[model samples]
Target: MTFKPLLAAALLATTAIAAPAFAGTKMKTEMSATPTSNIVETAVSVDALSTLVAAVQAADLAGALSADGPFTVFAPTNDAFGALPAGTVDTLLKPENKGTLSNILTSHVVAGSYDAASIIALAKANDGKAKLTTLSGAELKAYVKDGKVYVKDENGGKATVATADVQTSNGVVHVVTSVLLPK
Candidate 1:
């Protein structure tokens, strides 16, 4: 009855509830928000981000993320996690790797609300790239390539925004195609 077992079960159940999130699959997300939409809520509502919702629970970040505050989360789709090496996600979800898992998850978050337009403006102002300090204290850079927005982690990981400008009450969720790991 440990947290990890429960976490895995919950994730499995969610995957069953939502449409399978696969890589390179064009995902359509809600662009408008109601008063109830938040980062975690928006993610859960999306069929492409079921894995992300599960990780937030496993990392014990659901409460914190659901709190009142501006948090811009660069969420990775299920396909993004699937793109990782075999067993990488499984290993990270283990109880022993909670700290690492938390750090990795936080690496995708930034304090304060930043919409896609602002991010693009910042990137434009910064001469095509804007370096962002993540909630995990790691640095990720945002840049536009081929008319699409992308964020690069310190560890050379890059995640492209599959869907942008998903408004939420707490902040915004930009669905990305890869999991940006911590440095």
Candidate 2:
């Protein structure tokens, strides 16, 4: 056999063998490049929410909130729960209260995402008033006063967005100091 021919044959065989390895490497790389939403869903610590986190998990809404769609959640801090009538949190936590808790929690969530600036603009356009439809089928009124966002539920319960614009890959979170009770 000519040396040149042998060398060409050897090169062809090496190329063929490397093709599958290269393909496998490409697949691994693609798999590792997960979306930012997935990363945020995992890294974001809803654990700090304590009661609110537990309620979301109990209502089976953890996955929904973790989904790809952007959402703006007005999360109530633990102190907000304490402000409720005594035994209210305990009652809502019971298995029998799942539906009620789910409704109340979902009522805090609007269908689409909204940042503080957008919300303020909407409120201003509406002459310091804006109505937002919640996942619970209730209408929540939003207003801006003294440069702070405040939301009122059907029952006339109000919550001030104590902290606004907590950005996540999937959505934003605004911490509220009160629980909005729906009529």
Candidate 3:
């Protein structure tokens, strides 16, 4: 089978195993004051994003994410990482798995800073869904459902934006309820 199908299956399977039901609430990510740190630093500052921080470090993407070009990161929380099958994170963290880990991590990062409003508007303009290209060369569908913003992986697995428009010096961060896998 091709990697696209595999990625979709993996995402759906992982989500099915542990994702909690999202409360049907409107998306309300407020635009907070700009933070002085970059993406790495910003993510590190969040207690819930520790796993994502570790993965970024393990993937050796700290420097790139710290660079000048603004990026939009859909960061998964510790709980999201924990939702994966047992041993999944451990295996991905292995030194030999650096490439794979990097791909997975970069899949959550887009090239430019796309805030909540832009995403929502983009979706509304494009038939209720916007295709966002990630740094890993994957396409994620951004849409609004039940007044909440959600991102759908190529294979149809979805992640809710738990928080949005967290401004960092170099880019923006959106906390997501599940890890997004690339096709």
Candidate 4:
């Protein structure tokens, strides 16, 4: 029962007991360190983009989007799909209309990475409208209305960027209020 041996044992026991609490804090930090999802995964996670996700799958565009892409997508919400004329979305979903659906979806996609600030600057340079050539070979005009960016399609259909610059692993998504139709 020497004092030195007793003190050494006490120190060892204290360290061993305190290690678990520090380890528990480390585990909590690790749990929160989980990375963010990519664009397609982000779309799936959002409740508003369900229809857009379905259309992407139906058009066979999911794989391309999910893969490496610094793509800028003007993602339309489910309410945007619902805003179409009666039976429009159902008709587009038909197998025979896959080509048309593909075209429509592609028109909403641009080749490069365009965040809201850069797009706004481009618009400012080009007379308040930035002409973006889409993946479908169609042109989309980005303009600012009431200080918010809006992308206009060929048919005079306008989709407001209701939510701007949602950063993803591959690219950015500007959630639009309306579906953009190809001319």
Q: In candidate 3, residue 152 scores what lDDT?
A: 91
Q: Give the TM-score of candidate 2.
A: 0.74
Tens digit per residue, CA lDDT, model 4, 39-111: 6766766667889988888898888886688889989989999999999999998889999999999999997
Q: After superposition, how far is residue 11 of candidate 3 from its true place, in Å?
A: 32
- Higher-lDDT candidate among 1 and 2? 1
**Which of candidates 3 and 4 reaches a greater lDDT?**
3
In the range 82-176, model 3's lDDT, one tens digit per residue, is 99899999999999999999998888999988887778778879998988999989899988777677899877878888877667789887788
**Of 1 and 2, the candidate ranking higher by TM-score:** 1
lDDT per residue for candidate 2 within 1-183, as digits (tens), equals 001111222211211111121121111101110124321242233333567877776677777777776777777878888899999998988889989999999888886778766776777788877788888888888886554567898999988766555555677666677888776
Task: For candidate 4, give the lDDT of residue 7.
Answer: 23
TM-score, candidate number 3 = 0.82
Compared with the true structure, model 1 gives a TM-score of 0.82
Q: Which residue pairs of candidate 3 clash?
A: none
Error of 2 at 170 (Å): 1.5
Cα lDDT listed for each candidate: 0.75, 0.64, 0.75, 0.72
Off by over 4 Å in 3: 1-34
Rank order by lDDT, top first? 3, 1, 4, 2
